[model samples]
Structures are given as structure tokens and as C-alpha cells.
Target: MTQTFIPAVFYRGGSSKGLFFHARHCPPDHAVLERMLLSALGSPDPYGRQLDGMGGGTSSLSKAVIIGPPTHPDADVDYTFAQVAVDRPVVDWGANCGNLSSAVGPFAVDEGLVCAADGEALVRIHQVNTKKIIHARFPVRNGKAVTTGNATVDGVAGTGAPIALDFLDPGGTVTSGLLPTGQVIETIEIDGRAFDMSLVDASNPVAFVAANDVGLAGSEHPDTIETDRAVMALLDRLRRAAAVRMGLGQTPDSVGLANPKIAVVSAPATFVTLDGRTVEGAAQDIAIRMLSMERAHRAVTLTGAMCLAVACRIEGSLPHRLCSGHADMQAIRVAHPSGIVEAGATVFQRGNGWHVESGRVYRTARRLMQGEVAIAPFEGEGDR
Candidate 1:
């Protein structure tokens, strides 16, 4: 039997990595693409380790991105991100990957999908899943995107050229407004205990709860958070309750931790980072521990950063309480498990409530391996 080959490029964007595919080369049918993606990533492995395919098992690595010529009049490219489940044969097209979104501009510039200038290129991307615009700006040395520089970000090691991503009108991408539940804070009863949380809609829908409320010191390592089964189960229940309040209408058992993520936030007080460096309370405005797919995120997602940026500005919110004296600052440095990430946001009160005009963050990306990824024939489907 002849194996099917698909042209794809693997890239490391921010802290996560994913396979980037050209829309022109991908199967036009959604069903076909769905199966192909699962095979390419070796999903439904049950062992949760994608040992036979391109995926690295974790949620951040089990991803695929589809890009093409601009679909919107104001954008230079159309980007659709896919989150492939490592343990199940499911491809959730429910939200965009903020880390992977940083790579789209460089991919577009290299693939000839869009032309770029010699110095810097501004790529206007139409994010398909969320119906949002991500303005990606990066330096271009020579005729291609620059991959080397001194710019550094948390989670990712070393430094590289910076990619500035501005999410315009980032609010309400997945919900009705900035406060998806129509309130800055809401208390839910879980197992006879009341937990107050804020559901904010930025680049994605996220439920913010204080670290103390979720049983954490806010400075614990990912290993500690991931290994504690009881803690994880508690977070799942909290996330599911949030999903209901936010109108996500999906249970954690069925949905498997995404779309509307849960983040445990803490106030800015001296704490040690994952790398053993003490982060002074004065250096950061707030501390965050974001959960991606039910596990602790090494660093905050670009979307999560955007969500936190907005949350910090909303009065009475968990993040806002911790981020005191930063209401007038243009940017908020979010201290996560990895390090500090500074995200900028423009927010103000509108007719009804507080609104986020945009959210911005800096990231870097590099094309790793580019070639044809051969995949086995799908079950019941003939070889391509």
C-alpha cells in the first residue's frame, strides 16, 4: 500500500510547536482534512503519547495550522488553527492558538502566500475560528523573516527576533462581551464550597480564579500542578462550571479542556519563577497560572495573556485585585510559572460595561523542518 504524502512545515512558535500547512495543499473537504490531521499527529493513541507521528503528545505540540491567501478584504492571509487531541481522535476547531499565531506571518512570507518588505513585514491575518484580526509585525532581514535576535520571552529558551502581535477588538471572540457571564465576578458552589470567578472574553473565553481559591501558592511548578490528581479534578469541575456560565455548553468529560480555559491568578508578591529566579512583586503587575487542556501551561498563551490583560483592568475581578496600581499603565507584566510576560491592552468603559479595544503581545517564531509528511491511509478511506 502506498502511503499518502502531504507537504507541511513544522515550526516552533513562542513556547509551542505545530505543523503548518498551506491551504492550497490541504484537502478541500473538512472530513478529509480531519482524518488526515489525526493520522499525521497519531491521535487516539490511548497511551496519550503520539509516538508514531509528528505530535509531541502535549496539547501545545498536538496542533496543526492551515493558512491560505487572504479571505478577508483587510487581511493578507487567512489562518485556521486546529488543536488535535493526543488521547482521542478529535480535532477541535474551537479556538485559535496564540503561540502558533505568531508563526503565521513568517510562514506566509516564506511560502509566497504574501509578499513582505526587506526590513519588516506587517501581516494582517484573519483568524478563522474566532473571527478576529491579528496584526503580526516582525522584522525581515534580507528577503525573509528574521529568526535571530536578542528578544526573549518566557517558556521559550534563549532569544530571537521579536514578533509583535496585536489582537484588535480582541473582546467577545468567543462570547457576547468582555464579561461573558454579564458580571465582573460570579460565585459558584462546588462540593459545598463557594468559588468566585470571572469569565472574561478576549481572544478566547477564560475563567479567572484566584490561586488561593484553587489551592495553590501561585508559584508552584508545572510538575506539581500536573501530578496532583485531586487538584486537577477540582480544576476540571471549576472549568466545567465556568463553561456552563459562559454558554460554552460543553462538559469537561466531553470537551477535554480548551476553548474556554481556566486560569488561577495571584497577587503580585515576591515569588520564585520556574527557573529558580525570584520575581519581585514590584517587577510584575500580577501573577498567573494558566491551564491548557487541564494541565498547567509552561507559559501563558498569547490569547490567555490577552485575556489577563483585560481582566487586570476590570475592577473587582480576581486579576484586577492583584494588579493594583496598574490601572493606568499601558502594559501589564504577567508573572507565570515560566517567567514574566508583558501584554498590552487598551480598555475603557463603554455604554454598558468595560470593553477591551485590543490586546498586544510579543512573540518569536522559526520554521523548523519543512518537507513531505507521509501518512498511512485512513480507516475505511482509500489511499490518496
Candidate 2:
């Protein structure tokens, strides 16, 4: 079989990594695009390891991004994110990957898609999936984005330049409004039991449940959480039910694997990190454990952190009730299995309802590789 090459760049943005492509180099038809991405990432591998492709066998590592000229008037470029399932032939575009969003600006600047002078460069990004504008501010030198600095993200090792992401009006990203179900708190019954959760849609829709309600301390490592089959099954059911409530799907069985992520939250507690470091309870405002692609995430997703931050500010949400003392603080420190990540949200109550002015987080991104990714030629294409 002959192979075809597509120009792409591999980037590690925050804690997640993915392949980035220029829009001009990709086929316009989404069917063909999905096929190419699946092949390049080696999906549908029953063994759960994408050994034949670029994927690193996890949700955080199985991703693809496309960059193009802006379609929105307020943006400098267009950014689309795709989450490729490692063990299934599925590509979910229903939600945005906040971790990888940090790389879009640097990718644009380095590729000459956007011009920036030396100093703090600002790139207005049109997040296609969420229909939101993310203002990315980072340092630039010699006409390129600087990649070295003192900033460090929790999941990633070492320090790199910081990328400040301000999600403007990051409410109702994938739903009708911030409080998707028109309520700050709701109860969903699964397996003949009622579970109380907050379904908020800031940046990304998430169903936040108290850790004790799920029989957890919320400080467990990813491996420990993943090994608990009953908890995992319950979380999936809750996520699907929340998706239906948020109008992302008609029924629980029809919900996609990406959107409306389910998170378990608790008041801050002392715990040990994956790297064997100790995290004091008082150091963080709240603790969280999130699942992605049906696996316990080692660290909380950036968007999840932002959404939790926003949830903490809401009057009666579960997160707010758990961390009521820090509800009015500008920044909310979240404790995940990895450590602590700080996120901030500006929210206010209006006559209509609660309004989120913006959600902000800082991340680091670096271009790991720049070249072409080889894939088998399409079935109908002739050999070159």
C-alpha cells in the first residue's frame, strides 16, 4: 500500500498534546478529514494503545487541531479541535479542548498566519466548536512566539512561557445558556438512586457532583479511580443523563463521549500527588476528579477547571456550597490528582439571570515537531 503525507506540527499545549494542521492542507469534506485523522492517530485499537500512529494511548494525547483564517469578525484566526477516541473509531467535535487551545495562538504566529511584533503579542482566536472568542496573550521575540520562561503548568514537567487565555463571555458554549437546565442545581436518578449535580455551561458544560455523594474523597489518583468499576459506571451514567438534560442528546444512550463532562468535587483536602508530592488542603479551595474518554483524568481539564471556577461563583451550585468561603475570591485554586491549578471567572447576576463576563487561565505550549504525518492513501485515490 502506498502512503500520503500531510504537513502537520506536533505540539504539547498545557498538559495535553496533539497534531496541528493548516486548513489549506486538509480536505474540505469532513468525512475524508475524519478518516485521515483516525488513520493518523491509529484509532479503534482494541489493545487501547495507538502504537501504529502518533497517539500516546490516552484521551489527552489523542487529538487533532485545524487552523485557518477567521470566519468571525472579531478573531484573527479560526481554531477547531477534534478529540480522537483511542479505543474507538470516534472523533468528537462537540466540545473544545481548553488545554490544546493554548497552542493555537503560537501555532498561528509561527506559521505566519498572524503577524505579531516583539513583546506581548495578542491573538484573537475564534473557537469554532464553542462559538467563543479566546484572547491569547503571550511573549514573542524575533517574529516568533517565545517558548522559554518561568511559567509551569501542573501536569506538564518543567517551565515554559506562559499563555494567558481569556475566554470572553464563555457562557453557553455548547448549550442554550450558562445554566443549561435553567437551574443552578438539579437531581438526576440513575440505578434507582438520585444524584444531585450542577449542570453549568461556561467554557464547557460539566455536571458537578459532590465527592462524598459518589463515595469518594476526591483526592484519589487517576489509577485508583479508574480501577473502581462501579464508580466509573456510575459516572458514565450520570454524564449521559446530564447530557440529555443539557439538550446535547435526545437520550442517555445517544450522548457522545466528549461533551458535558462529569466531575466529582469536594472541599479541599490534604493528599499526595502522582509525583509523590504532598498537597495541603488549605492550599486549594476545592478538589476535583474528572474523567475523559471514559478514563479517569490524571489532571483536571483546563476548561473543566474554568467551569468549576465559574460554578464556585454561582450562588447555590454544588461547587459553591462546598467552597463557600472562597466563593468571592478572584482566583479559585483547584486541586486535582496532579496538584493545584488556578482559574478565575467573572460572574454577575442580571435581571435575566447569571452572566459570566469571562473565564481566564494560564497555560504553556511548545511546538514539539514540525513535519509531515504519513497515512495510507484513501481507498479511491490512485497511487502516486
Candidate 3:
């Protein structure tokens, strides 16, 4: 066969979109799977625009997911996330996509992977990449996951049914512990300059730095930040340095492109959002700007926001210091370029170290399309 077609479903989960497949339809060979995903997403495109495939030419849009029976006894289904690089042939499985996670339960219910009745339904998901459990709860009617509701997610237009996600025991997702270096706050040297940062790993690992230290206001638009070559280079250097310290990699170059995200943060400040709305500093507790797949994220990643919320609860962390005035609040208001998102985290210090009980957030997802995705056949591959 000149081409192969794989059954897939396209979904918009929170602020991100990805193609979903059942484990039964995927190739068992790791190498073949990588090639299929890369081709299906139109990766390795020098133009940075994935016009040839379903990808939307950004980190959040170039993604894939696999769902099957849960390997962990405590979960209902297994959800694995794959981050497909837009300009490279690499697919990073080092971390989980919190945005896409919201859709897993709905997909599972709609696809018959799980049984549900009317009213609210809960699907315990085993996040394969991070080895974590995410409890996804949403509304169900007529034996189908509800898609129409009044909930509004900042980065997404229109309203949809709200999905509440609770990440249990979210600490130490990709590193040694919540505070990877065994300190709430630490300093990393980049270009001979010492900069204070907090390396926190909750739903995902993130390196939080002061925006002022990096010569930024933390409210800059994604395009504006991406255009600044000097600032981009500096952030990458700091992120790599922190990754090494977090034990994600032995060398800076060994770190994967998706894990150990770097974020610039500051106290809430007035800023214009991508949708032309002005948000006041007083309306939010803290402001953030995060990077993913080497590009500025239009909005903060959901896991990154959850991690930031956990960091804010840590007394001495940079996020905590920035938003200390409202540190006592149960929910944290995170201001990003696209607007504001609220995340809640429960944490407390034990004799040995700090422990995170859970991180919570609300998002909406929609199934945009369901069909087979076509890809060119690889060499030596036969028709099934």
C-alpha cells in the first residue's frame, strides 16, 4: 500500500488540540510509531507551518494521544501523551499534557472505553508518561459526555461543559521531589550572572524565574517574547541549567525539548491579552509567561499553572514570594497572555520535606472530528 489509514479522533482539550487513537490501532514497534506520528502531524517542516497535516504549527497543536486499559490498578483507563515537534522529527514522551488530559475521560466515555450513566461521571486516568493518576469528572446525559455548557476557558472561544481535573499526589512528577534540589529557592548561573529560581515538579516540572531578572515584565505577548532572540537564548540557558540540577539529564544538551519547562513570573500587572482585553493587576494574584517546545506559549500550560499554584503555596519559592499577599487563598489566579486561569493546590511540609496532596483545575474539551488519518507508508511496511 502506498499509504496507511489509522482510526483517530481530533479533539480540542482546554487550550490545546491533538489526535487521539486507541492502543489497539497503534503499531507496537516504537520506531514505527514515531514515524507514523511524525508523518501524520507533518513534522520536520522547515517552514514551521504544518499545512500538510492536521497539526496547527505550534507546540500545543502538534500532539497525539493513546488510550487503553489501565496498567495501574487504581485507574479506569491508560492515557499516554506524545508531544510531536513541529520542526524536528523528535516526539517527547518525557511529560504529560494537562490540557489534553481533560479530554481523556470524555473520549473514553464517548468511545465506549468506560461505562457511564446520567449526571456527573468520573473516570480515573492513569497518566502513562508521568506515572500519575488524574481524576477527571464531567457531566453526562443520555449516556454521553455532555459537550454543551456555560463554562468558559480563557484561551478558548465559546463555552463548553466543564471538566474538573484532580491530580492526586502530584509531587515529583518528573524529578526527585517537589523541590528537586531539596530547597524551596535556589540560584542558577547563566552567562556569569546569578539568578534566583524555584524548580518545582508537580503535574509537571517547571523552572520559575523572576521576570525582572530576565529583563521582562512577565506580561509580554507571546509573539513579542518569541521575537527577542537575546531573551529566548537566556531563558533556554537557564532552563537547561535547571534541568541538569533537577536530575532530568546529566548534560544540558541531553534534556528533552518538552520537559522541564521554563516560566517567567511576577506579581500581577496590567496587560493586554491576545483577544484585545485588558486585565488589571489587582484582578489577578500573579502573572506568568511560559515556553513550550522552544516557542512562547500563547497561554500558560495547564500543568505549568498547577505547578505554579503548588509553588505559590511553598513559602519561600519565587512564585510564593511574588504572590504572597494572596498566598493564603485556596485557589490561585494565574494571569497569562491570553487571560486568567484559576488553579488550586493543597500542600504541606512533612518532617522530611514538602508533600503535595493534589492539584485541581477546570477545563473544557470538544471532539472536533473522528475518522481515519492517512499517512504515507514507510519503507518495508505492508498493508494490514
Candidate 4:
């Protein structure tokens, strides 16, 4: 009954925390790795609670990131993200983890994959899953990474140092074009009605729709939203339909890729945040809430926030309708379920069309533990 252990780091980056491992340390075989991850996270329970594993049994906690040497010339590290299902004992490699991305640079710097000076330095990371490059800017003092600053992100409780993240050419991260459909907005017929939607494939591909059309105020709590099984069912249908239209899948049920998230937006309105703080509509450009792995995110994902920023900057888009005319090509503030998150974008018009040059945001990361996870040797054997 001897168990084998794998080296891992349990760290909190932004609003989420997960187990992270260097890519080289993981097995190249799929079945073996999947089994190993299940034992590490403890899953396949019908109760939806992962009481026996490292997983907290939530979408945010059941995540893993694998970082290794980059395959691209300009990139410094290769990041592979996985979302392990708490109840399935299976890892879904179909999407990127935006929260964990904030830690890739620090991990690379700590692991000696990339070198930095005694001040602020830029670490280029190639998101291997999407083949996109992200410039992660972190502060360094005396040759070590510094994690102290005044910048505050809403989802996280305490204010710390800032990590400036610039996602270059998010439009082509997954494919070519900000609007994969080559249009800012399109009308889709679903359930015998026409819904205005925007399908964009930036850092993440997302289908943006109006909240009012979906019978929502865009200010509901995560628990309240998830409990409405009817709403969840409708969203699932919409997501599946959007997935097929975006060419990400052949059918609604096959829309499993976590990137190109699906979201609904609405004009800013007063709502009590997760922390119980009142968010004033006048102080925000737009109010939005997004779904992650088919559930409302407690706050918002960094990549999703990037997509929202891009949507806002573009004219004739749902996000643009919520703007107060203050957002420009450089910066825009979005109001999420947690509070407010500010994202930056580089854009310009070319040949009668608008293009997203890049998108940027700030996130924080910290290593919680460094150790190995043990598992039964029989697990993951010959698994496909």
C-alpha cells in the first residue's frame, strides 16, 4: 500500500488558489496523470464535496497549472492549465486558468527558468494551451521577487503589490480576429427568439449577451444565481449553442473548452458585493457576471476580465452600451460580482475595422505550500 508522491506548490493567486507543478515533473501519459491528479484532489463523489482530497470541492480550488520551458522563441515559459472536476476524478485540459497565470512569472523566476534584475522586470510567458504570449511585470528588489505594494484588486481581501499583466494580441490568441465571426455583434435565433450576441476569441473566447434578455439584473449573488436551476439550464443551452456557432464544438454538449467563456452583461446597478460592500453604479463602467465551468464565478477570472475589457472598447458591442463614455482604447473599469476590476487594452482602427492590440491587468500570487501528493499506484494505469 505504499503511495507515490509528486512535488507540488499550493499557492493563492488573485481570488483563487490551486496546486501547481512544473511541467517536466508530470508524466507525459494522459491516463497515468489523470489518476494521479484524482488521488491528489480526491474526487468521483456524488456528494459534490471533496472531503478527502486537496480539493475544496469548488471550481476555483480544483485547479492545477503545469509550467515548463517555453517552446516559442520569444516566450520564457510554457504554461499548461487544467481544471479537475471535483466529482469526476478527471482533469479537463480544455481551457486556461487566468488566476493561476498570475503566478507563472514568479514561479519561473523562483525556478530559475527566467532571470530578472534587482528592479521591475518583464517575464514573457507563452500560454501553451492557447499559443498566446503574455508579458508579466513584477517588482524585484535585491534580486528577489517583491510582493508588497499599494495596488488593490477587488476579489482579494488584502491590498498588496501590483503585478502588471499585458496580454498581447488577445484577438488572435485562440484564432485570428477579435470577433471570430468578423462582426462586432450578431443576432442568433434560439428557443424561438433572436438574441444579440458577440463572439470574441481573445485570450479567452466568450459569448456576450444582454442580462435583461436572460431575465437577470446582472447584480445577483453567486449562490442565488446558481440555485436557480431554470436559469442554469437556459445558460447551458445558450453556451452549447454558442459553442457550436463559434466552431469550438460540434454540439451543445460538446462545448467543454473553458476558454472563450460565456457571459451576460448589463448596465451598472447597485448591488452588495460578495464581501457585503455596496458597489455604486455611478462608479463603474459596466456591471457583469460570468460563468466558469458552468457556475457563476465568485468574482471574475483574469482572462474573462480581459475579454470584457476588449468588448467594452469595441463599438456596437453589448459592453459598450454599459460604458459611461469614459473608457478609451487604453483602459476601462468593469464592475464584477466581487467589486471592480480595471483592465487595459491596446487598440486601433485599421481598414474600417477595429483591432485589439493588447490587454493588461493586475493580479497577485503567493506560494502556500511546497510538497508532493501521494496516490495509489493502480490509479491512472492505462487510462485514456
Candidate 5:
């Protein structure tokens, strides 16, 4: 059988990388799309290595984003994101990819779907999966997207022009409101282990638990944590419990569930980062160890960081209790495995509950390559 050639742009969006495609160039059929994307990413491999395709094996690198003309009146582009599993036939479409959302603006401008005005350009994107609007502001010089600048993100090496992403009215992204459980804190008994956690919904739905509550110091490196099977399983159970409590599912055993990310957080303390540098408490508001696809993330996610930033300001939240009282709430610096990520949310009092007007994160994106991706005829397609 002849392989299908689909045009896509391979991009490095902050810490995650994916294939960016225009909707006009992709197959409209869902069956064909599943085969195409899985083949493009080399999914369902028992070996856990996606060596036969574009995926880099890890969840962060096994992603794809589809962009096109806006379907919403307030947006300039329609963005659909997909998280393809490396070792399984699962394509999780339950949430948006905040990191890849950073690159949609540049792809829109370059694809002629939207024209950016000279100087700084503001691109309003409609995230189809979550039905949220994201406003991206990036520098445009000589009618092209600027890729280099002085902005230095913790995970990405070198500096680049800052692409400011503002997720407006970010509450209820996957759930109903900022506090999905309608409670500041909830306790669950999982397999005889009692765990306390807070569920917050800003840019995304996340379960925040104190590291100490989970028998973790919040200072362990990602490599150490990832390799420990007991620790990973323990965190997964807590995360699943949070998901059921947040109404994502009936129980932890629910099938095909993947939203409501889980993060183990703690007060800022001295910790050796992934790059061998020490992150002192004085330099960060809080420390975090978030999981993506059941594996520890090397850096904090854009959406997860946004939720943490908002949770830090709430009156009675886990992150708030852990965050060192800071004079600048707009720059909530969070220490992660990579280094420190500054995530901010425009949050304030609206009676007894918190209201987040918008959340801001600075990320940089680069168009790695733009060409046709060939998907061979495979017997099975992946599901997420």
C-alpha cells in the first residue's frame, strides 16, 4: 500500500515538541486521522521506544497540534491538540497542550491563516478540546515571527523572544470552576493510605498535594522519582482518586480517563535540579513534582503552572499554604525539576471565592521543520 503524505510542521513549543498541522491539509475522516497520527508518532510499541516514527518516546515529545481558521467569533485560529501515547494505543484528547498552544500563533501567521501586524502581534486562539480562548503576544519583525530574544525559560536551553500566553477566564477548563471539587481540600483513603489534596481548575484541572503528605520531601530529582516504582504507583493512585472526586470519573478504575493532572507540591527548599544546580528556598515560592502520562515531568507544564500560580493566591489552598508570602503575586516563581518557572494568574477576591481574570506564561517556540509526514499502512490505530 502507498503511504499517505501529510504536511506538518515539526515545532519545539517550550519544553515539549510536536507536529503542527493545518486542518486544511489533514484528512477529515477520524479513522484515517487515527492511523495517520499513530503512524506519525509510532505508537503502541511494547518496547516503549518510538524509533520508527517522529515521536521522541516520551509523552512530552509524542504530541501533535492541528490549527486552522477560527470557528469562534472571538478567535483568529482553531487549535486542536492530541497527546499520543508512546507505549500504548491511546491518543488522549481530553485536554489542551499549553506548551504547543504557544506555537499556534507563529504557525497561524506563517501559514497565511492570519496576518500579524508589524511589531508585536496578538493572536487569539480557540482551543477546541477545552473550548477556551488563549491570547498570545509575540514579537514580529520584518513580517516574520521572531525566534530569538533575551527570554530564558528554565527547561529550554538558550534564550528566545518571549511569547506571552494569556489564558483568559481560564476557570472551568475541564471541570465546572476554579475549585472543581467545590472544596479547598479533600482527603481520600487509597489502598489504606490516606492522602490530602486540593483540586484547582485554572488553565487546567490539577490536584495539588503537599509533598510531605505523600511521604515525599519534594526535593528528589525526576530521575530518582521516575525510577522508583512504588513512588510512581502511589502518586498515580492519589491522582486517580482526585480525578474521581473532581467528577472526571466514577472511580480510579474508570476506563479511558486522562484529564485532571496531579502534582505533588511543597514549600520551597534546597533541592538538586536535573541540571545539577541547587534550587534554594529563597529563590522560589513553592516546589512542584507534576506527572504527565504517569511519568514525572522534567519541567512544570504551562497549564499546570498556571493552576499552581492561581492556587497559591487562594485563601485556603495547598499551594497557598506552601507558597512563601510574596509581595508580587503576578510572578509566582515555582521550583521544578528543571529549575524555576514563573507563572502568574490575575486572581483576586470576588466575594468568598477566587476569580482568575486571566493567567500569563512566557514561553518560546521554534519551527523545527515544515514538510510532509508519511504514514505507512498500519494494521491498528491508537486511542487516547
Candidate 6:
């Protein structure tokens, strides 16, 4: 009844960590793959702590990455990310994680799945969920991977080499256009109150609203935000309303799969980050606090940054109010609880519609460890 152990790499890509699996080791069938991954990560536990499995009992720790040679024509590698819940043994594969995408290129090169020359290699990764292309620029010296550099991320400590990520065609990844609601901004009546909302799908779909209306200053730390039961109640109501309006679904208690993320925005204010570094509020466009999977994220989500960038580039909206007046390119210095992270997007006026060629973001990742991971024994007969 012993399950075969497979070699994998445990990496901390940006603020998130996950186990990267070689594509060949994963099941090809969708249902079988889901079952195997659930067992492998040790999910569905009522206690919420993945003590008996590899999951680290949080969204940041509970993750998985699958990569290999391209199955489609225009891609170099197929990258898939899974978010495992802490309390439940479920993997939400409906969206893409740009933070974890940083680890994939190096993992592929180390596994000999792809070849890199003596210098930098361009990794074209096709996200399976959104089918969007994430272009990663990696440094390779002497046929080995380089994890050290001069690039520094807000949440992570120290400085390392830079990995420039270009998110192309961020619009319409899941839906049909950049503005999922067919408008740049709209007023939504939530709980008998009118709130200005921007529904955009740059890399993922998000509904941006003002923080003050939600009774938040938008500068509080994650712990402070998490403890407020009233804040969570308002967020839940907004999220449910936004989900239904965005064509996601009409389930009040269970819109888990269709995530209509709720984001609160405010004028920037100086604060000490969790890492003890001080960030100036004047240097940022707007302060943002995005809720992920119905919880306050330790740091701002990567795709959340993309949505912010896209918002800043537009002409009229909550984010557009903070734009620097430059019509060509806009850079948003988003302040998260951990620290400040920046994402940039170039805007061009093409007659009536705006064109966002790509979104640029910087993140740091390190290979923490590499070895074989042994899963619990499976006694049932093989489906295949």
C-alpha cells in the first residue's frame, strides 16, 4: 500500500511557497489528477492544520506547481498553479498565481525539462487556467541557475537578482474583455448604498471600491484587518453582489469557485511595513488592500497588482484619480501590509478603446530545498 515517492522542489517564489512537480509525475486525467493532488497535499482536514501533509496550513504555504514542455503550439512550457485551502482539502485552480510563476523557469531548467544557454533564457509559460502568456526573464550562467541578484521584493528579505515578468494579454483571460462589465466604471447599489466600482480582468477579475466607505483607512496591517468581524461582513456582502453582477453566479454562501475579489483603495499614507522597513505614502499612487479567498492577504496578490496597474492607466475611475498625468505609461506603487510593491502598465489611446500591451512586475524567489516527497499510501485500485 506504499505510494511511490516522487522527486520535487520546494521553493519560495515571492511571498508564496509551493511544491513543484514534474509534469510526467502528475496524472493526465483531470479528475484523477485532482484526487491525487488532494491526497498529496493532505487536504479536507477539519482541524485546518495540514499537520499530516505537505501543506503549510495557509494559502501562502498550501500551493502546487506543475510544469513541462509545451502541449500547445505557441508556448514553451505549460504552467499550472493550485491554491489549497487550509481548512479544506480543496485546490482552487480557477485562477493564475504570478508570484509562483517566478519559480517555474528555474525549476524547469534544473529538472532538465528545458535548455538554457550560457546567459539569460526567456521562458514562455502558458497558464492553463487563463491561457495567458507569462514571459519570464531568467539569468543562467555557466549552464547553472542563478537565484541571487540585486532585485529586492517588499515581503522577502535581502536583495537578489531581478526576474522581469511580462504579463501579456492580461485582459479576457477568463471572460471576453478587459472590462468584464462592459464599462470602465459603474455604480453598484450594495446594501442600499451606492458605491463606485471598477470591474476589470487584467490578469484576473477584481472589483475595486473605496476603503472609506467600507469603514477602513486602507492602511491597517493584515492582523488588524483580520480581527474586525464587521469588516469581514461588509466585504462578504460586497463580494457576493459583485459576483452576481459579473456573471459569476448567484450563490450567497458558496461563490467559492467564482471569485469576485473585493479591493479597498485610499490615498497613500506612510507606515512601517511588517519587515520593519518604512515606506513613504507620498511615493505611492494609492494604498490597496485586497481580500484573497475571503481573507486578508499577507501581501498584495500579484494579479491584484496587475489590476491596480490597469486601473491607473485608464482615464476615469478610482485608480485613475491617482494617475501621474502621463498618458503613455503609468506605474502604481501599491502599498501592502508587508511592504510596498510596484506594477507598471503602458496605456495607449487607440481611437475609442485603450490597449494594454503588457504589465510588468518584479518579484523575488529562492529555491529553499529539493528532494523526494512521499505521499500517504493509497490502497484503492488504480482507476486507469
Q: How many Å off is the CA of 275 in candidate 2? A: 0.6
**Per-candidate TM vs. native?**
0.96, 0.98, 0.98, 0.94, 0.96, 0.92
Candidates in order: C-alpha RMSD to true structure:
1.6, 1.1, 1.2, 2.4, 2.6, 2.4
* Candidate 3 backbone overlaps, count: 0
Can you write out model 1's per-residue Cα lDDT over 3-106, one digit (the tens) per residue?
A: 89999999999988999998989998998999899989988788888998999988888999999877799899999999998888789888889999999999
lDDT digits (tens) for residues 264-345 of candidate 5: 9999898887778877789988999988887788898888988899898887788888899543655899899999988888
Per-residue error for 201 in candidate 6, Å, reads 0.4
Give residue 184's error in model 6 in angstroms: 1.9
Off by over 4 Å in 6: 250-254, 322-330, 378-384
lDDT values, one for every candidate: 0.87, 0.93, 0.94, 0.79, 0.86, 0.78
Could you give candidate 2's per-residue lDDT for residues 1-384 as a string of tens digits?
488899999999999999999999999999999989998998878998999899999999999999999999999999999999999989999899999999999999999999999999999999999999999999999999999999999878999999999999999999999999889999999878998999999999999998888889888999998999999999999999999999999989999999989999999889999999999988999999999889889999999999999999989899999873554587999999989999999998998689999999999999999999988776788768
Query: Model 4 residue 271 lDDT?
Result: 85
Which scores higher on lDDT, 4 or 5? 5
User: Candidate 5 — worst ten consecutive residues by lDDT sum?
Assistant: 375-384
The parts of candidate 5 lying over 4 Å away from their true place are 255-257, 326-328, 380-384
Writing each residue's lDDT as its tens digit, candidate 4 over 94-136 gives 6677778888888888777888888887899998878888899
Q: Give the C-alpha miss distance for residue 299 in model 6, angstroms.
A: 0.7
